[model samples]
Target: MGILLLKLVVGLGNPGKEYERTRHNIGFMVVEELARRQGVVFRKMFWFPARQAKCRIGEHEVRLVLPTTYMNRSGKAVWGAMKKWRAEAADTVVIYDDVDLEFGGIRVRAKGSGGSHNGMKSVLEWLQTKAFPRVRVGIGPKPDGADMIGFVLGGFAEEELLKLEKVVERAADAVETIFSVGTERTMNEFNQLQIG
Candidate 1:
């Protein structure tokens, strides 16, 4: 199979201390893990309200971005990063949380709908395409009769945090696999993973 290159990875999350470590911010967690492993720092770009860092993996230069925009407004930052870095949709990967699966479960797709995710909707709307790759880290299903927003915004319980730590690690590994191989191989390898 031909190698599919990647130049940028965007992690979707809200900006603010309160949102830190929340289920919805798993994207941020994964990217932060990648940055730490790469020994790079996330610098705030003055032009756009996002934290970004550049590092090399294999023969490709890759960028890691965490949009400072609140989750609902994430598209603007993503679109801005693409323009600033001159990145094509094909060379970018978006990572975010999905509530439809069990916690720590991961699903990677080459391209697909945003479903009801506001952050993804914003990204797809701003990018003007759904043809980009994405890594959906499962945050588990919302409890019956629970408010969706509250469920997503809530932090993991003490025990769940232990499991989440492993999930975050695996999610970061999935991103690296995408860079080393291709999204198709990443999907096949990671989509079957059951972490936690």
Candidate 2:
């Protein structure tokens, strides 16, 4: 719980105007909220494939990253930032959308396989380990017989959009809590609540 001591917080998503706020970009949304809370703005980093901002959360100075390498190749950006920060796989936290849970659900784990997430798969491949912590924001249930790709890439429905900010805020809060309280305590406090 307390051991995830992270230096980098990466949000996986495809970079482009059209992709903004889409279901898959919820990871981006969470990091953006974290940046806002720290009063920092993300700027293009030529040295790496991402927009980065430096911010202090609790006692730890963490780098918030939004990968510009697109979803599937997110590992490239994350790995680059990890190298820049001299961080290992365990010293990073990955936040991404998961279609397996209902919308508003969030799952935080210390370590696990990438599962069916291509972006996470790429991260695992590049990092050569599955020991990193991750925050999976729910984006799912995919609708009856709908195309998985279309559902994830699509924007939230009008109703869901109403509560989007709150969900993002909750996710960001969970992250800060991880830094402050510890992952286990934070998970115990946050895991069961479904935001409206």
- Runs in model 1 lying further than 4 Å from the true structure: 1-6
Residue 55 in model 1: shift from native, Å?
A: 1.0
Global CA lDDT of candidate 2, please?
A: 0.89
Task: For model 2, name the residue pairs that clash.
Answer: none
In angstroms, how far off is 156's CA in candidate 2?
Answer: 0.4
Candidate 1 per-residue C-alpha lDDT over 1-196 given as tens digits, one digit per residue, 9 for 90 to 100: 4453449899999988999989999999999999999899999998787999998777678889999999999999999998998899988989999999789899999999999999999999998899999999998778899999999999987778878879999999998998889999999999988875
Off by over 4 Å in 2: 1-6
TM-score for each predicted model, relative to the true structure: 0.95, 0.95
Worst 10 residues of 2 by lDDT: 1-10
